[model samples]
Target: MAAGQHFFGPWDYVVLVIVLLISASIGVYYRFTGGKQKTMQEYLLADKNMSIIPVAFSLMASFMSAITLLGVSSENYTFGIQFIVINISYGIFTPVAAYLYLPVFFKLQATSAYEYLERRFGKASRLAASLSYTLQMTLYMGVVLYAPALALEALTGISKVAAILSVGLVCTFYSTIGGMKAVLITDVFQSLLMFAAVFSVIIYAVIDKGSFDEIWNIAERGNRTDLLNFNPDPTERHSWFSLIIGGGITFLSLYAVNQTQVQRYLTVKDLKRAQTALWLNWPILTCLSLSTSFSGLAIYSKYAACDPVKAKVINSPDQLMPLYVVDTMGDIPGLSGLFVAGIFSASLSTVSAAVNSLAAVTIEDYYKPLYKSIFGKSLSEKTIAIQSKLIALLFGLLCLAVAFLAQFLGGVLQASLTIFGVVGGPLLALFTLGMFTTTANEKGSLFGLLCGISFALWMAFGNPKPPLPALPVTTEGCSSVFTNVTVVAEPQLTRATTQQQEYFWLYKVSYLYNGVFGLLSTYIIGYVASLVINKIKGVSTQNLDPHLFITPIARRLERTMDIPLNTKELSDSQEELNGKYEVNGKY
Candidate 1:
């Protein structure tokens, strides 16, 4: 309970060191083996030869980092378990990602996802979307890098600077040297530790209390078990409607179109394998999400009467899990270290993914174009291979610097999701406009993306907003347990009673709806603007590329071409359609 007192024992440090060493060694192994990352494809996309299982695990680990581990548990402890309903939206949208959007990227097979935007719209559209993506990932990874620092500072009694530096340096080292191959394999190994960490809390809670049923019952009595809310109001925080509809949009925005996951999907052999990996990721993701949510209840059952935050044992709700581990399980030696290692692994997986993907975007989307514009030629493969590693290293350090600013952001879960929604929604709308409809053009889509981001940012942080009220907590039991420490009196919960009509209506809406607002704003405005521009300019749509659209739309458009086809011509077309469409004169 004193400052500078180390929570980890000797064995704890040993376990933690071994975990970090093993992670770094995986990168080393991949760097020295086969192809040796001599080409850009091998370095960035894993040479398109990865197995399905590792890719699936990597996909889950990349986004569901320590942010989920720390934030979701705190979310359930403070608000309730209603956040678990978002998993249902994941299942509902997995097919959309697998069948619809996955095919477009798979068929194109470009290193950067923004390259699809370039071919579909134009150079201007691609630049706009890619820069938005770069900003989004940088902000999200900054929050991710800050997560482990909280764990370290809480358990080890050290400054956050040490934690952030250790994680950033090691993650950047392995991901930079090992390339995509190392990232995927390390993610698989780290995914196991993530599961171990969450399970440790549940197992300890059962031992500390009597049984799982008692934990659930205690949580129910504490008013944290309410799950069913069908409210249709968009302003409601965690209702079935918000979780299902709004959460589904967020899911599509990330899993369907975001570059981090899309790059993972591209590492596999072909479209079928990629789709299989996408389907497999849902159950793995859902399992971790449900366990993490329950772990919150597991911690809450112990502090139901004597809240740690109320007792001033922890500074914030995010510190509750680490403090609980040190209080109840510190004597178990390696258990506490394993939990911290899991949190570290979560941050490593996410930050590494962002680092690699950001580098890829920079090379293909930004660097290549600038090089061509100034020099009138493409760079050699050797230069690309060398520069990709440097770009990855630079971006990792940039994200590390950004982590210092994450203290200004509030909760880890909301901050990460808010980033996804604010930027990801408009990007998803841009891709959807290109693939699903035939009317959207370059100028309109660029305008729509910029406006959508502006609107979402305003909704998320435009005005000073009230804090979300937590369930009732008390220090009645803490008074008997800690005689020397001062337990703060249970203050009145007044924020919930404040007049809702006082704040701006957009600010009053739930953070979950930010993506939905962005998607609607972009798609509706982009489509209408495109129609207006086409009418005024008298532009014709007769020569658009069929491959730019999805399969059904592309096939229908092929049938509507100007030249009439005989039976033999139709037969030839059927055979070509059965295989793949030509893009830029080659598949």
Candidate 2:
């Protein structure tokens, strides 16, 4: 399962210890420098004064965690080179997010990015989206928690349960205390460690494999080519179309609408600088993603013929990749620890981002509403900050429980693939309607959002609930006994064999298609519903102000600090309301 794991040794423990020290030192520094500032904005949004490098790097770190590193590597080990196709699809989404979607929310100066949903649609739709995000992110980070634990358990002989609890608790402690500032800064450190870990694995693979030319030849024969095919077809699964379209929609929502990334953008000086950060992100993330595939290729190149994984038999395919690492990669010393620690970086980045974003929604969307309703007053900034930490604690425990349950599921890739479109497809549709079409008013917004959710939910869980498939009964080092058995005696029940296996291409396509379908369905359905609403009201689309749907960055900058109402731009800024200038005041 692990492709080219020619290196694993006991000294790996020393390497892991050093990496842990580096990670912890950053946690301590953030603890010291930013310990006293606990106001809600400072705690939650990092005071909204961040620039492109820190924020962009933070976004990259968040997306490239253990799930991606381990999952993508496992994918290539099993399915061969097609894993690269799926990830290349994920790479091109950044620019689309910058150009088509980011400006509206930036101009609004939104605290909760989903507040855009509230303004254009209604509160119910907003709450539903935000709440769904919280649940999904919690489940998502839990999966992140579960992945590296698999690797750690295999390498160290640590209990898998212990590994999960350890990582989850540590991440929760740092994220809960450090808030956004801690998440951002720690992410930069994690990213560096991750890069070092990946490169070490690759370098070791280069030395362990016969030679570079020989490795490339094997990979080429295996068809590990073409990182940039555009349509290889949409429904075809992991083709270029699915990756670009599917990845585009998912990252668009992640960058433009999801609060985790949005919170980072808000920390920047202005839209221009935030966008500057956004533009820089694509190449760096593309590199990080490509490294995962490179690790997979190295694994395959090293472990092709007499797969040493046969030495320690495991039922689950997910176990194969990690087992290869411990048994084979461990032949070397510090290298194994660095690679395993790399997996840790992936998981930590994902968990920190998820917890921070979840806490933000809890404080802003849920608690703030309740506080205002009861006190008929606003709470102090300090109270909101305290509440966010409590929310982080509650959700961190919830996610830990989910991580324990994820171990019951199939391989990590399948677990992630299974939930791909459940809510995201519909959420994508609802947001598109809200942002683009004026006729998508409250009625259309609620209807379209619900329809999107129900449709995706139906597809994800409604399909025949797959109780894990049965693997052929086997001993360590499977011998393909079918040939020997057929030679000796006539077969009774025909068995599943090479012919029974699904094609390799589909393995990539399944994940890509779920996302692509969700995005397309939501957009088409929500757009149609908007047209219907416009007809019902006997209203022309032209009546709505164009600026609301198509606001530009330069125009928004010239407005006073306040987000203004849709009105004819007045030549004068002199008008005052109750001793406050209307245009100059924040909404």
The best candidate in terms of TM-score: 1
Taking all chains together, each candidate's TM-score versus the true structure is 0.94, 0.82
lDDT of every predicted structure (CA atoms): 0.85, 0.64
The digit string of per-residue lDDT tens for model 1 on 1-587 reads: 43224478888889998998888788788888946988988988988899999999998998997988899999999999999999999999999899889887877777899888877787788889889999999998889888888998888876889888988888777667878888999999999999988888999999888899999999999999999888888878889999988889999998989988999999998789999999999999999999999999999987887887777776778877887788778888898888899999778878888889999999999999899999999999999988988998998899899999988778888888888889988889999999998888888877888889899999998886756868898778775544355765556768876546477778878899999999999999999888888788876666555666777787777687653223234334644542453322233
Residue-pair clashes per candidate? 0, 22
Query: What is the alpha-carbon lDDT of model 2 when measured against the actual structure?
Result: 0.64
Model 2 Cα displacement at 522 (Å)? 2.6
TM-score of 1: 0.94
lDDT score of model 1? 0.85
